[model samples]
Each structure stands twice: as structure tokens, then as C-alpha cells.
Target: MKEEHMAKDKPASGIPPGSWPVPLGLPLYVTVEQAAKLAGIGRDRMYEYVNSRADPIPQMRVGRAKTLIRTSAIPDYLRRRETA
Candidate 1:
């Protein structure tokens, strides 16, 4: 029974068994605050990351005040931050 036809199941893929595919069907853009929540970080911290010179999270300024981040950028940022 352990041997299967597929490569791996949901849990092995880091997805809960009954959970729906996420971020896959999510919007491409999200506000800075929303990005923070998605990344499990504080809004203030997200802004700090945005302002950091070392490795800032790339973001886009919509119009004058709205700041939006690309949905893929958050995970990409984390992947870059991964040391081990």
C-alpha cells in the first residue's frame, strides 16, 4: 500500500490532505498589509523589508499611495533567504 502510482500526495507536497490549492488560484497582486499576513510577518516588518537595502522585497507603487506586491515575490524572497 505504501507504493503508489503518483509521485507524492498532498501532505508530502506540503499541502494539507483536504486543503484546496492555495496561492495557485489567488490574485497576482496584494497590498503590503496582505502580503505581510500571507508571509506570516508583521505589516511594519513587511514595510521594513521593502525599505531594506540588503535584500528588499520588490514592490510596486500603485498611483500615489497604494503599494502592491507580486504574489510570487513573497515565496521567492523566502527561497532566497533560505540558508540551509
Candidate 2:
């Protein structure tokens, strides 16, 4: 049997050297301020939306102290506004 030699620098599946894995879920790291900017709303308005029972709500509370928003949700939020 021939021995298989794998390159040390390449990923196990042979994905190209410079390629990154596609993100599986939404990118969720924006601050409330950043989310507000992306939503084209004021920070206080974002707080209102977070407090309301609205669909397409982008903000999520992680643990007790950390709050985050998925970047992918911004477009949905904007579209919701347009249809409202």
C-alpha cells in the first residue's frame, strides 16, 4: 500500500490554504449602539424594540451582562419597517 502524505499547513479536508469556513449561523456581535446604527434608529428606539414583542428583533441577551445583535438580522428589521 502507498503511504499518504498530508501537507502540514493545509486543513484536514484539503480546503485551500487561505479559505475560511463559511459562518454557519448569523454573525452576532454588534453592540446596541452598532445595531442601532445599522437599523437606522436611535439607541433609545432600539431599546424600545428590544422591550417590545416585535418580530425580527435583532438583539439578544447572552448570560446576564452581555447583549448582542446579529448582523444578518439588520436587513430583516429594515424590511419590516418598510412594510409597516
Best by TM-score, which number?
A: 1
Q: What CA RMSD would candidate 1 show?
A: 8.5
With candidate 1 superimposed using the best TM-score fit, by how many Å does residue 34's alpha carbon deviate from the native? 0.2
* lDDT string, candidate 1, 25-79, tens digits: 6777889999999999899988988888999887888999998888778998978
Question: Candidate 1: minimum summed lDDT over ten consecutive residues — where?
Answer: 3-12
What tens-digit string does per-residue lDDT give for candidate 2 at 1-84?
Answer: 122445565667777854443244434567777778877899997766666775636677888977787777667766776743
TM-scores for all candidates?
0.64, 0.56
Backbone clash count, each prediction separately: 0, 0
- Lowest summed lDDT across 10 adjacent residues in model 2 is found at 18-27
What stretches of model 1 exceed 4 Å from their correct place?
1-22, 82-84
Candidate 1 TM-score to native:
0.64
TM-score of 2: 0.56
Clash list (residue pairs), candidate 2: none
